[model samples]
Target: MKALQITGAGEYGIANVPQPTILDDQVLVRITLVSTCPRWDIAMLGGKDMFDQTRPPDYPLPPGFPGHEAVGVVEAAGPSVQGLRPGDRVAALEHLQGQGAYAQYMAYRERDLLKLPDTVSDRKAVSTELLKCVVLGLDQFEDVKGKSMLVAGLGPAGILAIQVARLWGARVIGIDVSPERVAAVNALGIGEAVLADSLGDRRFDLGYDCVGAAPSVQNVLDRTNEHVVIFGVLRGELIYRDRFWMNGIKLESHKARPVTERYRRLLLDVLTRPEMNTECLQTKQISFKLYAEGVETLKRQEAVKICFNPQEAF
Candidate 1:
């Protein structure tokens, strides 16, 4: 079994190791494909903490340290693992700790993974892990129907947010600083969008902030008619304006939830939607050996997301 290890900043090496053993409640999955998490991969390669970028990162990121998004076929399942078995096409709907999913095989808790229907292709289902993350925020609101929702960034997460919000019956308006991203959102035809600088007196029933900066959060807090959900990595101290208080504008920070049956169902529900396809976001796919090259592409902003085929060797 080959697993990826970041020996140092900007350096990586693959080593053949014994395959992982499954526990009573775990499943050993034969990985077919794994996807890059731009932020985490960039941070690991840059030798910085993903959450605290200013801090230095530890070297040799626990083989397969950051590779969580995956689609695989279950090779074996422990006795306690019910409802999942060998030959089931699946993806880990949640992050498995130090999963080393970048390898050809990984052992993950049965509860952390979910079997996928044949209708979902590996390329499309590869994004399901992220879809679960995006749903964490959207599901926070009981209902978004007929609401005017502002998506405060047009990156991958924000784009998914726009689609989900729309699917949930909300009219969406996406905003981003980059015209390219704004144009991308507009091209999707799922929502209305405008450049951040071009935003003039635009307001929404609620705002979903995917850009975790002070300006972005403040922008939503100021313009939203009723509520706001902070889904981005909040970095700076935010000031709550008096007007926000006077208007009774509500705000909620997205919370992390452990993977569960509900999320598995949500992942399938969202992926099965014809209007919710994100296949265009997968700009590149490469053999797992080319991870360094893919990260370089991500650093250059050359791709929305890169998929890695783990079964292919050097």
Candidate 2:
């Protein structure tokens, strides 16, 4: 089996690795598509010790796989696994001890799998985890309809957040450093796009900063009026201005929240509506064999959602 491995701190390499052996209660999936996560790259670049709890205590294991968003087909099933069998297409959460969505195959506990509906495409199915995170954040606030939301960055998560916020009937404003991304979001007519640096002294009711930079987080605090949601991963200290705390603003940071069964069912139900049109979430599509290229493509600030087919080389 071919797999992309995080060999050490700040390094990644491709290798033909041993296929996973299945247990009686495990499920094996033939990976079809996967997307790169920016936080994973930041963790690798900063050294494994940078993250507090999320980083596995055992640092820098040999040839570890690092991906979480993926879609696949169930190629084999364990004896104890019920209701799922070979050829059942599924999308799954890709965070665990030894597996990553970057591999040709992954073995998972049967309980973690979410069977994809026939109405959903593989690309949209791969995005469930991403959408789930946004839904979790949005669920925290109540009755945002007709209220204003300012998403301060238009990365993959930011773009989805923009759309989801709009779907909830909130008037949305999106900001990004990339002119191309601003143009793209403007074309969608989902919200108003603004340049991050151009917001001299404006404020909004709800603001979200999806850029992981400490400065960007501070900027979100500085520019937002009342409620601020820090949705992106930040590594270092962000200094806030003295008046920042005096604004009577509620600050919410992203914490680890498991997808509850209720939310899972809600996500799948909303996804089943064929007219939802998830294609806007994707910015680039590359073959799965070009995994390294996919990783590189997402490094660009303008890239929204980069997908990999996993069956061909770059």
Candidate 3:
């Protein structure tokens, strides 16, 4: 099996790695599609613990297959597994020290795999992982009705967050530098998407930081009138205690939680929504031959959400 292996900090490549065998409680899955989580991957590459660091190192430490969002078909099931069987289409939680899904096959615990309805497509189901993260954030911020909200980045996470905010009945605003992304948001009827730089001192009731760039943090401070929910992966020493303190602002941070009870319900809610399931469509598919090129595209913020097709090489 070919897996995208992160050998060390700042180094990762798609190599022919051994396929995973199912354990007593684990099920073997043939992955149909896997989305790129560049923020999470970049954090690990930069030697930062964005959750899943306390788990006592199951597969390996520091460097391993690092992707949490995936959609797949079950190939085999362990003896103890009851609900899931071979040939069942499922979406598996790929975080929490699990095998990477950016390859042909991976093994997961039966509990980690959720049986998807026949209505869901592989891309849409895999995309729900990003929605799960947004749902987690929404769960944390109680009662956002009628209040205005802003999503500071327009990536998959940001886009989903926008839709969720609107679904919760909040008058939402989405901010990003890319006009192309803004257009996509408009076409999808998610929210009022605009370029972050184009806005001139318009204040928001609640704000979200999805980019994690230093400037993005500052953008939150500049626009937020009350609270800011940071659903994105924030890195580096960007802080403004005074700015928040003076305005009586609140900052809530979120991390990936696929195994916990709180996150499980949130994931279910997101999966149940039809509007969120089909939010954005990529213009180009990144094949394995262009793996390095895709990585560079993510690093440069050129691609909104890029998925590497392993079969393209096979």
Candidate 4:
């Protein structure tokens, strides 16, 4: 089996590694599609420990898989793995165990796999794991119905947030530095899209900052009326002024919530629904051999969501 490894800062290579062995409660997945998460993966590649600071900066991370959002077929199942068997299609939540998904095969606990519907294609199903995280972020909001919401940063997560917020009956406004992303959001018919620099004298009841920079946080605090949810991973310092303190504004930072049976089922249901509209979020699809090229494209903000097909040879 071959897997991706990060040798150093801003460096990665494909390494031939042993195939994963499953435990009694585990199953082996033959990865079909893997989705790139730019923020986390890019940071890790640059030698920044975004998740945990205590861990040493070691080269060639364990499992060495950069992608966490993946959909695959069950290649094998262990003795205790019931209800799931070989040939079953499933979405893998590999990030929960600090494992990687950018490989031909990986082992996962049976409980960590979510069976995908036949109606969902592998390309769309690749977004399942990240959609679950989007669902978790929406869960953090209070009484969104009839309220106005602003989503700063029009990446995949932000775009999904706009759609989900609209489904909740909120008047959504999407802001991004990219004109192309703004146009895409406008074309979705879910909300009003505007350039970040042109947001003048506008205010929203709730704001979600998908871009974790301090400036984004400041933009949300400057325009939102009530609360702002920080959904992106922040690596910089957050500084505020006296008005921010006096306004009684609430700031909440959110990470992907724990996946449970109920939430998993809900996410699948939402993804399968016609009105959810996930197709617009997928900007590019590439092969595992071009993984670095895809990452570079993402770094240049040329694509929103890049899915990889591991079966394709270079």
**lDDT for every model?**
0.83, 0.72, 0.71, 0.79
Q: Which tens-of-lDDT digit does each residue in 1-314 have in candidate 3?
A: 77766555555566776778888888888877777776665455545555544332232322225666777888999899998999999886644365566678878888777788887777777766667667777666687899888788888778778777887888888888888778877877767898888888788888878877667977886688888777765655567668678878877677555467666665666667786634263434666556556656776767766764455543
lDDT for each residue of candidate 1 in 131-241, tens digit (9 for 90 to 100): 888888988877899999888987778878999888889988888988877887688686788988787897888889998998999988888888899998897988888
lDDT of candidate 2 over 212-272, digit per residue (tens): 6777887777777777778876756876656767766777787657776887786886578
| TM-score (all chains, Cα) for each model | 0.95, 0.83, 0.81, 0.89
- Residue 137 error for model 2, in Å? 2.0
What lDDT does model 3 reach?
Answer: 0.71
The candidate, 1 or 2, that scores higher on TM-score is 1
lDDT measured at residue 171 in model 3 versus the true structure, 0 to 100: 89
Using lDDT as the yardstick, the better of models 1 and 3 is 1
Error of 1 at 105 (Å): 0.8
In candidate 1, where is summed lDDT lowest over 10 consecutive residues? 92-101
Please write out the lDDT profile of model 4 over residues 1-314, one tens digit for every residue: 87787777777778888988888999999988888888766667767765764452477776545678888999999999987999999987544465688778888898778898898888767877778877787778767899898899989889888888888789998899889889988887857889999988989989899888888877887888878888887647776667767888778888565688878777787778777777766688876567667778888888886877776632
Error of 3 at 87 (Å): 2.0
Clashing pairs in 4: none
TM-score of 4: 0.89
How far is 276's C-alpha from truth in model 1 (Å)? 1.2
